[model samples]
Target: MTTKSSLNAAPRRFALINDRIITAPKEVVPVSVLRALASIAADQVLVRDHGSPNDMVLDDRATVDLNDGNVFYTRARCDATPPAACGSPAKLAFAVDDTFELSTAAELPFEAFMALFGLEAGKQLFRDFESPNDQPVAPGSVLRFKDGPVFYTRGGQHHDARVEITIDGVKHKVAPGKTSGADLKKIGNVPLADELIQNIGGKLTPLADDATLCIAGGEEFVSHPRCGASS
Candidate 1:
């Protein structure tokens, strides 16, 4: 019989991917491959265990196998420089996956905090606003350290929240505010459907709002289905 003390005594396990180590549990479970890929956010190929291709599938479900060394290598772009070596003008500190981390900030024009992170303008910073969007906040306004890479994803709505849905028939989830044609394709590892399908109230509906994250799986309307073969 397993006791609470024994469970506590077990050391946590982690899998290393693209330099980031992600927590893994004793039980194998499904995780979003796209999300993990997005975390790297680089134009390059990834290989696992030296030779195995680290490719994401339509289902996008993956398990971090502890038996394997859980190693991944990136074939980064030739022209691209690692953020750490970019000689950023400032640094921002934040927490990702309960791990405190830092990132370099671009030495460019001062803008809103979210804008600093390449987000759409007018998105609030840490869900707060000191002034209107037109009023730009100077660089380093959001971080106390103000000397390394800017870690601002922790301030956005999509920090941990993702919208799950079934595209065609596979189950997958994309980060909030990223449900559009181009974004969904990248996240779901599949082609964009000529016709958008969404589940709503035990019925299927034409997916009109591709910008918001409130979407979920619903029933398709059998008669005059909005997202069916008739479309």
Candidate 2:
């Protein structure tokens, strides 16, 4: 009986990004060998075999990083097995020397700017007016009050009455006129929307002439992205 040689006895190199595989060198090489080499180099790798002009298969295979900070990804495809419908040809293009950067928590915006990432404050305050229910404000719930500058009360005493209230460490000021508690509640819950106005040193405009309300944060908000991408 005749014996068949291993298809991937020798490997080739290639580069990949943006879902497109770089063409291999002019010299013919075994596809399996190229995949094996790539798998060895990256923590995660993908291969696409374009054995035919029209057919492609994206083989999702990758290596995992245990202690290393790098992320690897790969895909593969083959052309000879089915209808000729693949998008491109398989070829070695170039070598990818990637430098991975670690993402730190410091990159996230402060609580005052949480609105940019769609996060809301856990606790908020309404100035001047009293809540209909005589209950301590709950976390993660909106608090409403009547419009006008809020009079800060300390030790059962009314302090300086100002439109601005410092929540946690973030400062939110009310508009000059009256606003309903409902309107203030909506503004506090929208971190991005409010922060945008606050950052510009602008006032939160009243929804209606009869509206009067304000909101303040309890603590600074912070966010961090678990990971990011780069070439």
Candidate 3:
């Protein structure tokens, strides 16, 4: 079983790409070649498709099925809704058996294409690449350092309380107000928590509301006892 402490210690990062394969040395390969390599099952592979405005293609994937002969892919698709369609891009995910291969139609080198797979993972990958300082926390988020990174939920809607911090150096998601207290305790060392709570209350606080603190882009509201309603 993978322990939280051990998992947090591992290194991972995120890289952005249009349609390419990212290699161990952090090189970008064409998407076609990446698809071919994935067909053969490469180790520790990540694939992503940063959609272009005119292309209308969606692809964002991450996978680690090398030795066993499995390929995984993810797609992040843009929604047709007004804001989502205009602002957000489309995404998708895919997984295939090792027997798969890049079709002859592809034009890029396999190595170059593989680089695109790791974009989302690249963010965490960058964290893993950099020396461990404080774990990356959103500006207005409160982070409680226990045996690992523990996120606490301020009172709101009742949701899953147990939260697990990823020690693998990979980024894990913890819903803003949905994580459980039991989850926070599992991280241990609850007393040593730190808060980046913003003064503004509510999910969408205007930047002018709190001059004392600046909010990060796309920050959701998280309520804390000491910080009140923060991002």
Candidate 4:
């Protein structure tokens, strides 16, 4: 029965529950609804697994906080299979600018994906972008099953085959995405004994030889001689 007090309660909230999503009704969620939303049975257990230190059981809880992303998992009450019986890790295959798709099993967030690939805000991920009616993928979305799924991206940021950077006032075009300081040095033909530095906001920042960098256009780099004044 709908009551005036319940209607006047706080707004409803959404949370990720065991590969599925659920919403709280007036800040208080019933267990039945939670299971229904998660496609789990009543006998299943909702666990908050973190580490060996402490793992809380969430089945007894009625309300979960929002504002911060809420994540929960559901497991069988009794497990006959061994720990090693778990299924294979999920794999997500994605590509940008109609490039070949690459698979990843890591639970990497969308922001990290953008940074690693030098993707900009305009770059958007979608399902079946080749089709007439394509669907847009929400940021931070995940595919949890062990089966590998593919997605596509389209945007101007991914259209560029190479990024143009200036090294010691010399312009060079290099592949976009993750790069190492050694690769930049090689591209600039800097002496092996010299150190590589990046120029940003008029400040010179040192770059490690093996350091991974997200290549972008118009980036300025300088090579400094390693030898210092002899005392």
Candidate 2 lDDT, tens digit per residue, 2-79? 111111221222233333333333233343444554543333333333334443333333332111111123432232
Report every candidate's CA lDDT: 0.36, 0.29, 0.27, 0.53
Ten-residue region with minimum lDDT total, candidate 4: 1-10
Q: Specify the highest-lDDT model's number.
A: 4
- Output the TM-score of candidate 2: 0.17
- What TM-score does structure 1 among the candidates reach? 0.26
RMSD of 3: 19.7
Better of 1 and 2 by lDDT: 1
lDDT score, residue 2, model 1?
13
Clash totals, every prediction: 13, 37, 56, 0
Measured against the true structure, the TM-scores of the candidates, in listed sequence, are 0.26, 0.17, 0.19, 0.32
Worst 10 residues of 3 by lDDT: 143-152
Clashing pairs in 4: none
Alpha carbon lDDT of residue 103, candidate 4?
33
Given candidate 1, what's the lDDT at residue 172?
A: 57
| Decoy 4 TM-score against native | 0.32
Residue lDDT tens for model 3, 60-135: 2333222211123433333311222323222322111111122212222222222333222123211121221223
At residue 211, candidate 4 shows an lDDT of 89
